[model samples]
Target: MTNLMETLVENREMVQPNHANMLDTAHGGNVMKWMDEVGAMSAMLFSGETCVTARVNQMNFERPIRVGDTAYITAYVYDSGTSSVKVRLITEREDLRTREREKTTESYFVYVAIDEHKEPTTVPDLTVSSEEADRLRREALEGENGNC
Candidate 1:
Protein backbone atom coordinates (compact mmCIF):
# COMPACT_ATOMS: atom_id res chain seq x y z
CA MET A 1 0.00 0.00 0.00
CA THR A 2 1.06 3.57 -0.65
CA ASN A 3 0.12 6.28 1.79
CA LEU A 4 -1.46 9.34 0.24
CA MET A 5 0.70 11.55 2.43
CA GLU A 6 3.82 10.09 0.87
CA THR A 7 2.70 11.03 -2.62
CA LEU A 8 2.17 14.72 -1.93
CA VAL A 9 4.09 17.17 -4.13
CA GLU A 10 4.59 20.92 -3.94
CA ASN A 11 6.15 23.12 -6.60
CA ARG A 12 6.56 26.84 -7.22
CA GLU A 13 7.36 28.79 -10.36
CA MET A 14 7.88 32.51 -10.76
CA VAL A 15 5.67 33.77 -13.51
CA GLN A 16 7.75 35.09 -16.39
CA PRO A 17 6.89 37.27 -19.35
CA ASN A 18 6.61 34.27 -21.60
CA HIS A 19 4.18 32.65 -19.23
CA ALA A 20 1.91 35.69 -19.15
CA ASN A 21 -1.28 36.49 -20.95
CA MET A 22 -2.38 39.72 -22.62
CA LEU A 23 -3.27 41.22 -19.24
CA ASP A 24 0.24 40.45 -17.93
CA THR A 25 -1.14 37.67 -15.79
CA ALA A 26 -0.15 34.03 -15.99
CA HIS A 27 -1.70 32.33 -18.97
CA GLY A 28 -4.44 29.81 -18.39
CA GLY A 29 -2.65 27.12 -20.39
CA ASN A 30 0.56 27.70 -18.48
CA VAL A 31 -1.22 27.35 -15.17
CA MET A 32 -2.97 24.20 -16.32
CA LYS A 33 0.28 22.69 -17.55
CA TRP A 34 1.94 23.43 -14.24
CA MET A 35 -0.93 21.79 -12.39
CA ASP A 36 -0.74 18.74 -14.65
CA GLU A 37 2.97 18.34 -14.03
CA VAL A 38 2.47 18.46 -10.29
CA GLY A 39 -0.39 15.99 -10.51
CA ALA A 40 1.80 13.64 -12.55
CA MET A 41 4.53 13.86 -9.96
CA SER A 42 2.08 12.78 -7.29
CA ALA A 43 0.80 9.97 -9.41
CA MET A 44 4.27 8.72 -10.23
CA LEU A 45 5.17 8.72 -6.58
CA PHE A 46 2.09 6.77 -5.71
CA SER A 47 2.46 4.31 -8.52
CA GLY A 48 6.23 3.85 -8.34
CA GLU A 49 6.29 3.95 -12.11
CA THR A 50 6.08 6.36 -14.97
CA CYS A 51 2.54 7.65 -15.36
CA VAL A 52 0.67 9.23 -18.22
CA THR A 53 -2.17 11.70 -17.90
CA ALA A 54 -5.45 10.04 -18.77
CA ARG A 55 -7.94 12.73 -17.81
CA VAL A 56 -8.44 16.09 -16.19
CA ASN A 57 -11.80 15.96 -14.49
CA GLN A 58 -12.26 19.57 -13.37
CA MET A 59 -10.05 22.64 -13.47
CA ASN A 60 -11.19 26.05 -12.33
CA PHE A 61 -9.12 29.21 -12.16
CA GLU A 62 -10.53 31.63 -9.63
CA ARG A 63 -7.90 34.39 -9.76
CA PRO A 64 -5.17 35.78 -11.90
CA ILE A 65 -1.48 35.49 -11.06
CA ARG A 66 0.52 38.56 -11.91
CA VAL A 67 3.76 38.22 -13.84
CA GLY A 68 5.84 39.08 -10.80
CA ASP A 69 4.05 36.63 -8.58
CA THR A 70 4.84 32.97 -8.08
CA ALA A 71 2.56 30.06 -8.79
CA TYR A 72 2.70 27.74 -5.81
CA ILE A 73 1.32 24.35 -6.74
CA THR A 74 0.45 21.39 -4.56
CA ALA A 75 -0.73 17.90 -5.46
CA TYR A 76 -1.45 14.60 -3.76
CA VAL A 77 -2.87 11.23 -4.42
CA TYR A 78 -6.45 11.17 -3.20
CA ASP A 79 -7.59 7.87 -4.69
CA SER A 80 -6.57 5.10 -7.06
CA GLY A 81 -7.70 2.13 -9.09
CA THR A 82 -5.74 -0.89 -10.15
CA SER A 83 -4.14 1.01 -13.01
CA SER A 84 -5.01 4.61 -12.38
CA VAL A 85 -4.09 7.20 -9.79
CA LYS A 86 -6.37 10.13 -8.99
CA VAL A 87 -4.71 13.32 -7.79
CA ARG A 88 -5.97 16.62 -6.48
CA LEU A 89 -4.05 19.72 -7.50
CA ILE A 90 -4.21 23.26 -6.14
CA THR A 91 -2.52 26.42 -7.32
CA GLU A 92 -1.95 29.57 -5.30
CA ARG A 93 -0.68 32.96 -6.29
CA GLU A 94 2.20 33.96 -4.03
CA ASP A 95 3.37 37.53 -3.70
CA LEU A 96 7.01 37.36 -2.77
CA ARG A 97 7.34 40.84 -1.30
CA THR A 98 4.23 40.56 0.82
CA ARG A 99 4.84 36.84 1.44
CA GLU A 100 1.18 36.11 0.95
CA ARG A 101 -0.53 33.35 -0.96
CA GLU A 102 -4.05 32.99 -2.27
CA LYS A 103 -5.74 30.02 -3.82
CA THR A 104 -6.11 30.69 -7.51
CA THR A 105 -7.03 27.32 -8.97
CA GLU A 106 -8.08 23.78 -8.12
CA SER A 107 -8.26 20.62 -10.20
CA TYR A 108 -8.40 16.86 -10.31
CA PHE A 109 -6.43 14.66 -12.69
CA VAL A 110 -6.29 10.96 -13.41
CA TYR A 111 -3.03 9.30 -14.40
CA VAL A 112 -2.36 5.78 -15.54
CA ALA A 113 0.76 3.93 -14.56
CA ILE A 114 2.67 2.75 -17.59
CA ASP A 115 5.14 -0.06 -17.98
CA GLU A 116 8.39 0.03 -19.90
CA HIS A 117 6.44 -0.91 -23.00
CA LYS A 118 4.08 1.98 -22.44
CA GLU A 119 1.26 -0.31 -21.44
CA PRO A 120 -0.99 0.42 -18.49
CA THR A 121 0.12 -1.28 -15.28
CA THR A 122 -1.30 -1.83 -11.87
CA VAL A 123 -0.70 0.58 -9.00
CA PRO A 124 -0.58 -0.25 -5.37
CA ASP A 125 -3.44 0.46 -3.03
CA LEU A 126 -3.65 3.93 -1.48
CA THR A 127 -4.09 4.89 2.14
CA VAL A 128 -4.46 8.10 4.14
CA SER A 129 -2.19 8.04 7.14
CA SER A 130 -3.07 11.27 8.91
CA GLU A 131 -6.14 13.29 9.75
CA GLU A 132 -5.15 16.01 7.30
CA ALA A 133 -4.69 13.43 4.57
CA ASP A 134 -8.08 11.97 5.35
CA ARG A 135 -9.63 15.42 5.22
CA LEU A 136 -8.09 16.19 1.86
CA ARG A 137 -9.26 12.87 0.47
CA ARG A 138 -12.73 13.53 1.79
CA GLU A 139 -12.80 17.01 0.35
CA ALA A 140 -11.70 15.75 -3.05
CA LEU A 141 -14.31 13.05 -3.00
CA GLU A 142 -17.00 15.48 -1.80
CA GLY A 143 -16.13 18.10 -4.42
CA GLU A 144 -16.32 20.71 -1.70
CA ASN A 145 -16.51 24.37 -2.75
CA GLY A 146 -16.77 23.10 -6.32
CA ASN A 147 -13.06 22.41 -6.51
CA CYS A 148 -13.43 18.91 -7.89
Candidate 2:
Protein backbone atom coordinates (compact mmCIF):
# COMPACT_ATOMS: atom_id res chain seq x y z
CA MET A 1 0.00 0.00 0.00
CA THR A 2 1.31 3.39 -0.90
CA ASN A 3 1.27 6.27 1.54
CA LEU A 4 -1.38 8.78 0.48
CA MET A 5 0.58 11.73 1.77
CA GLU A 6 2.95 11.40 -1.14
CA THR A 7 0.15 11.30 -3.67
CA LEU A 8 -1.10 14.83 -3.30
CA VAL A 9 -0.99 17.12 -6.32
CA GLU A 10 -1.24 20.85 -7.00
CA ASN A 11 -1.92 22.26 -10.41
CA ARG A 12 -2.42 25.78 -11.72
CA GLU A 13 -3.59 27.34 -14.92
CA MET A 14 -3.92 30.85 -16.20
CA VAL A 15 -7.44 31.96 -16.89
CA GLN A 16 -7.50 32.71 -20.58
CA PRO A 17 -10.19 34.51 -22.51
CA ASN A 18 -11.47 31.24 -23.89
CA HIS A 19 -11.84 29.91 -20.39
CA ALA A 20 -14.16 32.76 -19.42
CA ASN A 21 -17.82 33.20 -20.06
CA MET A 22 -19.71 36.14 -21.55
CA LEU A 23 -19.27 37.94 -18.27
CA ASP A 24 -15.51 37.79 -18.72
CA THR A 25 -15.16 35.62 -15.66
CA ALA A 26 -13.78 32.15 -15.52
CA HIS A 27 -16.48 29.75 -16.56
CA GLY A 28 -17.76 27.23 -14.06
CA GLY A 29 -17.11 24.42 -16.50
CA ASN A 30 -13.44 25.30 -16.77
CA VAL A 31 -13.06 25.36 -13.03
CA MET A 32 -14.78 22.02 -12.71
CA LYS A 33 -12.49 20.56 -15.33
CA TRP A 34 -9.45 21.74 -13.41
CA MET A 35 -10.77 20.26 -10.20
CA ASP A 36 -11.56 16.95 -11.86
CA GLU A 37 -8.10 16.65 -13.36
CA VAL A 38 -6.38 17.41 -10.08
CA GLY A 39 -8.59 14.97 -8.21
CA ALA A 40 -7.83 12.26 -10.73
CA MET A 41 -4.12 12.88 -10.34
CA SER A 42 -4.37 12.41 -6.61
CA ALA A 43 -6.38 9.23 -7.08
CA MET A 44 -3.81 7.84 -9.46
CA LEU A 45 -1.08 8.65 -7.00
CA PHE A 46 -2.83 6.72 -4.25
CA SER A 47 -3.76 3.76 -6.41
CA GLY A 48 -0.49 3.70 -8.38
CA GLU A 49 -2.74 2.99 -11.34
CA THR A 50 -5.48 4.66 -13.32
CA CYS A 51 -8.62 5.99 -11.70
CA VAL A 52 -11.87 7.55 -12.82
CA THR A 53 -14.28 10.11 -11.41
CA ALA A 54 -17.08 8.22 -9.77
CA ARG A 55 -18.78 11.21 -8.21
CA VAL A 56 -18.40 14.85 -7.24
CA ASN A 57 -20.33 15.51 -4.07
CA GLN A 58 -20.51 19.26 -4.39
CA MET A 59 -18.83 22.14 -6.22
CA ASN A 60 -19.56 25.66 -5.03
CA PHE A 61 -18.22 28.68 -6.85
CA GLU A 62 -18.01 31.53 -4.45
CA ARG A 63 -16.51 34.20 -6.71
CA PRO A 64 -15.37 34.93 -10.20
CA ILE A 65 -11.82 34.88 -11.60
CA ARG A 66 -11.07 37.24 -14.40
CA VAL A 67 -8.87 36.57 -17.38
CA GLY A 68 -5.12 36.94 -16.78
CA ASP A 69 -5.63 35.63 -13.28
CA THR A 70 -3.96 32.43 -12.13
CA ALA A 71 -6.17 29.63 -10.94
CA TYR A 72 -4.43 27.46 -8.37
CA ILE A 73 -5.87 24.08 -7.44
CA THR A 74 -4.77 21.58 -4.84
CA ALA A 75 -5.88 17.98 -4.51
CA TYR A 76 -5.11 15.47 -1.81
CA VAL A 77 -6.45 12.15 -0.67
CA TYR A 78 -8.14 12.58 2.67
CA ASP A 79 -9.67 9.13 3.07
CA SER A 80 -10.20 5.89 1.22
CA GLY A 81 -11.96 2.57 1.16
CA THR A 82 -11.23 -0.69 -0.51
CA SER A 83 -12.13 0.57 -3.95
CA SER A 84 -12.52 4.30 -3.68
CA VAL A 85 -10.79 7.41 -2.38
CA LYS A 86 -12.08 10.78 -1.26
CA VAL A 87 -10.21 13.80 -2.58
CA ARG A 88 -10.46 17.37 -1.35
CA LEU A 89 -10.08 20.13 -3.92
CA ILE A 90 -9.61 23.85 -3.30
CA THR A 91 -9.34 26.48 -6.02
CA GLU A 92 -8.01 29.97 -5.60
CA ARG A 93 -7.52 32.84 -7.98
CA GLU A 94 -4.54 35.21 -7.93
CA ASP A 95 -4.50 38.57 -9.63
CA LEU A 96 -1.13 39.32 -11.16
CA ARG A 97 -1.62 43.05 -11.31
CA THR A 98 -2.73 43.54 -7.74
CA ARG A 99 -0.92 40.49 -6.35
CA GLU A 100 -4.03 39.48 -4.53
CA ARG A 101 -5.67 36.10 -4.02
CA GLU A 102 -9.14 34.88 -3.24
CA LYS A 103 -10.65 31.48 -2.99
CA THR A 104 -13.01 31.05 -5.93
CA THR A 105 -14.15 27.44 -5.63
CA GLU A 106 -14.27 24.49 -3.29
CA SER A 107 -15.32 20.90 -3.93
CA TYR A 108 -15.06 17.32 -2.72
CA PHE A 109 -14.79 14.47 -5.17
CA VAL A 110 -14.93 10.68 -4.89
CA TYR A 111 -12.91 8.59 -7.28
CA VAL A 112 -12.80 4.86 -7.87
CA ALA A 113 -9.52 3.12 -8.48
CA ILE A 114 -9.47 1.17 -11.71
CA ASP A 115 -7.15 -1.20 -13.46
CA GLU A 116 -6.19 -1.32 -17.09
CA HIS A 117 -9.21 -3.50 -17.65
CA LYS A 118 -11.40 -0.62 -16.53
CA GLU A 119 -12.65 -2.62 -13.56
CA PRO A 120 -12.78 -1.44 -10.01
CA THR A 121 -9.60 -2.18 -8.09
CA THR A 122 -8.73 -2.08 -4.45
CA VAL A 123 -6.65 0.87 -3.31
CA PRO A 124 -4.12 1.36 -0.55
CA ASP A 125 -5.46 2.54 2.77
CA LEU A 126 -5.15 6.30 3.26
CA THR A 127 -2.90 7.43 6.07
CA VAL A 128 -3.36 10.69 7.88
CA SER A 129 -0.11 11.44 9.67
CA SER A 130 0.03 15.22 9.41
CA GLU A 131 -2.12 17.96 10.81
CA GLU A 132 -3.03 19.10 7.32
CA ALA A 133 -4.30 15.62 6.49
CA ASP A 134 -6.38 15.57 9.63
CA ARG A 135 -8.02 18.84 8.72
CA LEU A 136 -8.63 17.69 5.19
CA ARG A 137 -10.15 14.47 6.47
CA ARG A 138 -12.57 16.39 8.64
CA GLU A 139 -13.50 18.66 5.76
CA ALA A 140 -14.07 15.73 3.47
CA LEU A 141 -16.38 14.11 5.98
CA GLU A 142 -18.47 17.24 6.08
CA GLY A 143 -19.26 16.60 2.45
CA GLU A 144 -20.79 13.27 3.37
CA ASN A 145 -23.67 15.19 4.90
CA GLY A 146 -25.10 11.97 6.34
CA ASN A 147 -25.30 10.41 2.88
CA CYS A 148 -22.16 9.92 0.87
Candidate 3:
Protein backbone atom coordinates (compact mmCIF):
# COMPACT_ATOMS: atom_id res chain seq x y z
CA MET A 1 0.00 0.00 0.00
CA THR A 2 1.10 3.53 -0.71
CA ASN A 3 0.22 6.30 1.69
CA LEU A 4 -1.53 9.29 0.18
CA MET A 5 1.13 11.57 1.57
CA GLU A 6 3.78 9.55 -0.19
CA THR A 7 2.22 10.39 -3.53
CA LEU A 8 2.14 14.11 -2.93
CA VAL A 9 4.02 16.18 -5.53
CA GLU A 10 4.58 19.90 -5.70
CA ASN A 11 6.19 21.86 -8.53
CA ARG A 12 6.91 25.54 -8.98
CA GLU A 13 7.15 27.43 -12.26
CA MET A 14 7.85 31.04 -12.89
CA VAL A 15 5.42 32.50 -15.38
CA GLN A 16 7.56 33.93 -18.16
CA PRO A 17 6.55 36.12 -21.05
CA ASN A 18 6.34 33.13 -23.32
CA HIS A 19 3.92 31.45 -20.96
CA ALA A 20 1.61 34.42 -20.80
CA ASN A 21 -1.39 35.18 -22.91
CA MET A 22 -2.52 38.51 -24.35
CA LEU A 23 -3.41 39.71 -20.85
CA ASP A 24 0.11 39.01 -19.56
CA THR A 25 -1.18 36.17 -17.47
CA ALA A 26 -0.18 32.57 -17.73
CA HIS A 27 -2.02 30.83 -20.52
CA GLY A 28 -4.65 28.29 -19.64
CA GLY A 29 -2.99 25.71 -21.86
CA ASN A 30 0.32 26.19 -20.12
CA VAL A 31 -1.26 25.76 -16.71
CA MET A 32 -3.08 22.65 -17.86
CA LYS A 33 0.15 21.17 -19.21
CA TRP A 34 1.91 21.79 -15.96
CA MET A 35 -0.94 20.28 -14.01
CA ASP A 36 -0.92 17.19 -16.19
CA GLU A 37 2.80 16.69 -15.73
CA VAL A 38 2.67 16.97 -11.97
CA GLY A 39 -0.50 14.92 -11.74
CA ALA A 40 1.13 12.14 -13.69
CA MET A 41 4.10 12.22 -11.36
CA SER A 42 1.85 11.79 -8.37
CA ALA A 43 0.06 8.89 -9.99
CA MET A 44 3.31 7.19 -10.88
CA LEU A 45 4.50 7.59 -7.32
CA PHE A 46 1.38 5.96 -6.01
CA SER A 47 1.29 3.13 -8.54
CA GLY A 48 5.04 2.53 -8.89
CA GLU A 49 4.51 2.25 -12.62
CA THR A 50 4.37 4.46 -15.63
CA CYS A 51 0.98 6.07 -15.88
CA VAL A 52 -0.94 7.70 -18.71
CA THR A 53 -3.58 10.34 -18.38
CA ALA A 54 -7.00 8.80 -18.77
CA ARG A 55 -9.31 11.69 -18.00
CA VAL A 56 -9.27 15.23 -16.73
CA ASN A 57 -12.29 16.39 -14.80
CA GLN A 58 -13.55 19.91 -15.22
CA MET A 59 -10.80 22.46 -14.64
CA ASN A 60 -11.69 25.74 -12.98
CA PHE A 61 -9.62 28.85 -13.44
CA GLU A 62 -10.74 31.14 -10.66
CA ARG A 63 -7.94 33.66 -11.08
CA PRO A 64 -5.04 34.50 -13.31
CA ILE A 65 -1.36 34.01 -12.61
CA ARG A 66 0.40 37.11 -13.80
CA VAL A 67 3.71 37.06 -15.51
CA GLY A 68 6.65 37.15 -13.06
CA ASP A 69 4.54 35.46 -10.43
CA THR A 70 5.36 31.97 -9.30
CA ALA A 71 2.88 29.23 -10.01
CA TYR A 72 2.78 26.57 -7.37
CA ILE A 73 1.24 23.34 -8.62
CA THR A 74 0.45 20.56 -6.20
CA ALA A 75 -0.89 17.08 -6.83
CA TYR A 76 -1.64 14.04 -4.71
CA VAL A 77 -3.42 10.78 -5.08
CA TYR A 78 -6.82 10.96 -3.42
CA ASP A 79 -8.37 7.76 -4.75
CA SER A 80 -7.50 4.71 -6.78
CA GLY A 81 -9.09 1.70 -8.36
CA THR A 82 -7.62 -1.56 -9.65
CA SER A 83 -5.64 0.26 -12.33
CA SER A 84 -6.58 3.89 -12.13
CA VAL A 85 -5.45 6.67 -9.79
CA LYS A 86 -7.23 9.94 -9.25
CA VAL A 87 -5.12 12.96 -8.40
CA ARG A 88 -6.28 16.23 -6.95
CA LEU A 89 -4.40 19.18 -8.46
CA ILE A 90 -4.33 22.76 -7.27
CA THR A 91 -2.48 25.74 -8.69
CA GLU A 92 -1.68 28.86 -6.73
CA ARG A 93 -0.31 32.22 -7.72
CA GLU A 94 2.47 33.46 -5.48
CA ASP A 95 4.22 36.80 -5.44
CA LEU A 96 7.75 36.14 -4.37
CA ARG A 97 8.35 39.72 -3.31
CA THR A 98 5.58 39.75 -0.71
CA ARG A 99 5.29 35.98 -0.29
CA GLU A 100 1.56 36.20 -0.83
CA ARG A 101 -0.29 33.36 -2.47
CA GLU A 102 -3.80 32.41 -3.53
CA LYS A 103 -5.31 29.49 -5.36
CA THR A 104 -5.96 30.16 -9.04
CA THR A 105 -6.90 26.80 -10.52
CA GLU A 106 -8.14 23.42 -9.38
CA SER A 107 -8.89 20.12 -11.08
CA TYR A 108 -8.86 16.36 -10.79
CA PHE A 109 -6.91 14.09 -13.17
CA VAL A 110 -7.24 10.36 -13.58
CA TYR A 111 -4.37 8.14 -14.70
CA VAL A 112 -3.94 4.50 -15.43
CA ALA A 113 -0.85 2.51 -14.68
CA ILE A 114 0.65 0.66 -17.58
CA ASP A 115 3.18 -2.13 -17.98
CA GLU A 116 6.09 -2.41 -20.37
CA HIS A 117 3.73 -3.87 -22.94
CA LYS A 118 1.49 -0.84 -22.60
CA GLU A 119 -1.24 -2.78 -20.89
CA PRO A 120 -3.11 -1.60 -17.86
CA THR A 121 -1.88 -2.95 -14.55
CA THR A 122 -3.19 -3.08 -11.02
CA VAL A 123 -2.12 -0.47 -8.51
CA PRO A 124 -1.66 -0.64 -4.78
CA ASP A 125 -4.28 0.71 -2.45
CA LEU A 126 -3.97 4.23 -1.12
CA THR A 127 -3.69 4.87 2.59
CA VAL A 128 -4.16 8.09 4.48
CA SER A 129 -1.67 8.36 7.32
CA SER A 130 -2.28 11.69 9.00
CA GLU A 131 -4.92 14.28 9.66
CA GLU A 132 -3.67 16.38 6.80
CA ALA A 133 -3.91 13.49 4.41
CA ASP A 134 -7.42 12.71 5.56
CA ARG A 135 -8.44 16.30 5.18
CA LEU A 136 -7.04 16.48 1.68
CA ARG A 137 -8.93 13.37 0.70
CA ARG A 138 -12.14 14.75 2.10
CA GLU A 139 -11.66 18.06 0.36
CA ALA A 140 -11.00 16.36 -2.95
CA LEU A 141 -14.22 14.40 -2.62
CA GLU A 142 -16.35 17.30 -1.44
CA GLY A 143 -14.88 19.75 -3.87
CA GLU A 144 -16.27 17.64 -6.70
CA ASN A 145 -19.76 18.64 -5.63
CA GLY A 146 -19.13 22.27 -6.49
CA ASN A 147 -18.52 23.79 -9.89
CA CYS A 148 -14.98 23.09 -10.95
Candidate 4:
Protein backbone atom coordinates (compact mmCIF):
# COMPACT_ATOMS: atom_id res chain seq x y z
CA MET A 1 0.00 0.00 0.00
CA THR A 2 1.13 3.55 -0.68
CA ASN A 3 1.17 5.79 2.34
CA LEU A 4 -0.47 9.16 1.90
CA MET A 5 2.36 11.10 3.48
CA GLU A 6 5.07 9.54 1.35
CA THR A 7 2.91 9.51 -1.76
CA LEU A 8 2.67 13.28 -2.02
CA VAL A 9 4.00 14.85 -5.24
CA GLU A 10 5.12 18.40 -5.83
CA ASN A 11 6.12 20.46 -8.85
CA ARG A 12 6.92 24.09 -9.57
CA GLU A 13 6.41 26.25 -12.60
CA MET A 14 7.54 29.77 -13.23
CA VAL A 15 4.68 31.91 -14.38
CA GLN A 16 5.58 33.59 -17.64
CA PRO A 17 3.93 36.40 -19.53
CA ASN A 18 2.65 33.99 -22.12
CA HIS A 19 1.08 31.91 -19.40
CA ALA A 20 -0.93 34.86 -18.19
CA ASN A 21 -3.94 36.69 -19.44
CA MET A 22 -4.42 40.34 -20.39
CA LEU A 23 -4.83 41.10 -16.70
CA ASP A 24 -1.24 39.98 -16.19
CA THR A 25 -2.40 37.17 -13.98
CA ALA A 26 -1.87 33.50 -14.57
CA HIS A 27 -4.56 32.05 -16.82
CA GLY A 28 -7.09 29.65 -15.43
CA GLY A 29 -6.24 27.12 -18.12
CA ASN A 30 -2.59 27.15 -17.10
CA VAL A 31 -3.51 26.59 -13.48
CA MET A 32 -5.72 23.69 -14.43
CA LYS A 33 -2.90 22.25 -16.49
CA TRP A 34 -0.54 22.38 -13.56
CA MET A 35 -3.11 20.80 -11.27
CA ASP A 36 -3.81 17.99 -13.71
CA GLU A 37 -0.15 17.24 -14.20
CA VAL A 38 0.59 17.16 -10.50
CA GLY A 39 -2.50 15.09 -9.79
CA ALA A 40 -1.51 12.57 -12.46
CA MET A 41 1.95 12.28 -10.96
CA SER A 42 0.50 11.48 -7.56
CA ALA A 43 -1.87 8.93 -9.01
CA MET A 44 0.85 7.19 -11.00
CA LEU A 45 3.11 7.07 -7.98
CA PHE A 46 0.41 5.42 -5.90
CA SER A 47 -0.82 3.05 -8.62
CA GLY A 48 2.57 2.16 -10.13
CA GLU A 49 0.99 2.56 -13.53
CA THR A 50 0.17 5.21 -16.07
CA CYS A 51 -2.92 7.16 -15.13
CA VAL A 52 -5.29 9.48 -16.97
CA THR A 53 -7.68 12.07 -15.64
CA ALA A 54 -11.11 10.63 -14.91
CA ARG A 55 -12.79 13.59 -13.28
CA VAL A 56 -12.02 16.97 -11.78
CA ASN A 57 -14.02 18.04 -8.79
CA GLN A 58 -14.73 21.64 -7.86
CA MET A 59 -11.76 23.75 -8.93
CA ASN A 60 -11.98 27.17 -7.45
CA PHE A 61 -9.49 29.94 -7.93
CA GLU A 62 -9.24 31.59 -4.58
CA ARG A 63 -6.73 34.20 -5.68
CA PRO A 64 -5.05 35.35 -8.83
CA ILE A 65 -1.41 34.52 -9.36
CA ARG A 66 0.39 37.27 -11.17
CA VAL A 67 2.99 36.76 -13.83
CA GLY A 68 6.57 36.57 -12.56
CA ASP A 69 5.41 34.54 -9.58
CA THR A 70 6.35 30.92 -9.06
CA ALA A 71 3.55 28.42 -8.93
CA TYR A 72 4.01 25.64 -6.42
CA ILE A 73 1.60 22.77 -6.78
CA THR A 74 1.36 19.77 -4.48
CA ALA A 75 -0.79 16.70 -4.84
CA TYR A 76 -1.36 13.55 -2.86
CA VAL A 77 -3.45 10.46 -3.11
CA TYR A 78 -6.22 10.90 -0.57
CA ASP A 79 -8.40 7.93 -1.49
CA SER A 80 -8.59 5.05 -3.90
CA GLY A 81 -11.06 2.63 -5.43
CA THR A 82 -10.68 -0.44 -7.64
CA SER A 83 -9.05 1.45 -10.47
CA SER A 84 -9.38 5.07 -9.52
CA VAL A 85 -7.19 7.25 -7.35
CA LYS A 86 -8.47 10.47 -5.82
CA VAL A 87 -5.94 13.27 -5.47
CA ARG A 88 -6.18 16.62 -3.79
CA LEU A 89 -4.28 19.43 -5.51
CA ILE A 90 -3.28 22.62 -3.78
CA THR A 91 -1.68 25.56 -5.53
CA GLU A 92 0.24 28.46 -4.05
CA ARG A 93 1.95 31.44 -5.58
CA GLU A 94 5.40 32.42 -4.39
CA ASP A 95 6.89 35.83 -4.90
CA LEU A 96 10.43 35.06 -5.95
CA ARG A 97 11.68 38.45 -4.92
CA THR A 98 10.12 38.48 -1.46
CA ARG A 99 9.99 34.74 -0.75
CA GLU A 100 6.35 35.00 0.26
CA ARG A 101 3.57 32.62 -0.64
CA GLU A 102 -0.18 32.83 -0.97
CA LYS A 103 -2.66 30.06 -1.60
CA THR A 104 -4.31 30.46 -5.00
CA THR A 105 -6.40 27.42 -5.70
CA GLU A 106 -7.50 23.96 -4.55
CA SER A 107 -9.15 21.07 -6.32
CA TYR A 108 -9.82 17.35 -6.09
CA PHE A 109 -9.17 15.23 -9.14
CA VAL A 110 -9.68 11.54 -9.87
CA TYR A 111 -7.42 9.50 -12.12
CA VAL A 112 -7.73 6.01 -13.48
CA ALA A 113 -4.81 3.81 -14.21
CA ILE A 114 -4.78 2.39 -17.71
CA ASP A 115 -3.10 -0.48 -19.50
CA GLU A 116 -1.56 -0.46 -22.95
CA HIS A 117 -5.00 -1.00 -24.43
CA LYS A 118 -6.33 2.01 -22.54
CA GLU A 119 -8.45 -0.21 -20.32
CA PRO A 120 -8.70 0.64 -16.67
CA THR A 121 -6.20 -1.11 -14.42
CA THR A 122 -6.34 -1.77 -10.73
CA VAL A 123 -4.65 0.41 -8.16
CA PRO A 124 -3.49 -0.63 -4.74
CA ASP A 125 -5.23 0.55 -1.61
CA LEU A 126 -3.94 3.66 0.16
CA THR A 127 -2.66 3.63 3.72
CA VAL A 128 -2.39 6.58 6.04
CA SER A 129 1.00 6.60 7.78
CA SER A 130 0.66 9.40 10.30
CA GLU A 131 -1.90 11.36 12.22
CA GLU A 132 -1.60 14.28 9.84
CA ALA A 133 -2.00 12.02 6.86
CA ASP A 134 -5.05 10.38 8.37
CA ARG A 135 -6.56 13.77 9.10
CA LEU A 136 -5.99 14.97 5.57
CA ARG A 137 -7.59 11.87 4.12
CA ARG A 138 -10.55 12.21 6.39
CA GLU A 139 -10.97 15.87 5.52
CA ALA A 140 -10.81 15.15 1.81
CA LEU A 141 -13.52 12.52 2.15
CA GLU A 142 -15.67 14.81 4.22
CA GLY A 143 -15.20 17.59 1.70
CA GLU A 144 -17.29 15.58 -0.72
CA ASN A 145 -19.53 13.97 1.86
CA GLY A 146 -17.63 10.69 1.39
CA ASN A 147 -18.41 10.64 -2.33
CA CYS A 148 -14.73 10.85 -3.16
Best by lDDT: 3
In model 4, the Cα lDDT at residue 37 comes to 93
**Most accurate candidate by TM-score:** 3
| Residue range with the least summed lDDT across 10 consecutive positions in model 1 | 139-148
Q: How many residue pairs clash in each candidate?
A: 0, 0, 0, 0
Evaluate residue 96 in candidate 1 and report its C-alpha lDDT on the 0 to 100 scale. Answer: 90
List the global CA lDDT of all models.
0.92, 0.84, 0.95, 0.90
Task: Choose 2 or 3, whichever is better by TM-score.
Answer: 3
lDDT of 2 by residue, 1-148 (tens): 6665687798888999999999998999999998999999998988887889998976778999888898989888888888998888889998777868888888778899888899999998777787876776777677566333
CA RMSD, predictions in order: 1.4, 2.1, 0.9, 1.9
By lDDT, the better pick of 2 and 3 is 3
Model 3 — TM-score against the truth? 0.97
Q: Candidate 1's residue-wise lDDT over 53-130, tens digit each? A: 999876778999999999999999988998999888889999999989999998888899999999999999998889
Evaluate model 3: give its lDDT.
0.95
TM-scores of the candidates are 0.95, 0.90, 0.97, 0.93
Question: Tens digits of per-residue lDDT for model 3 on 1-148?
Answer: 9999999999999999999999999999999999999999999999999999999999889999999998999999999999999999999999999989999999999999999999999999999989999999999988766635
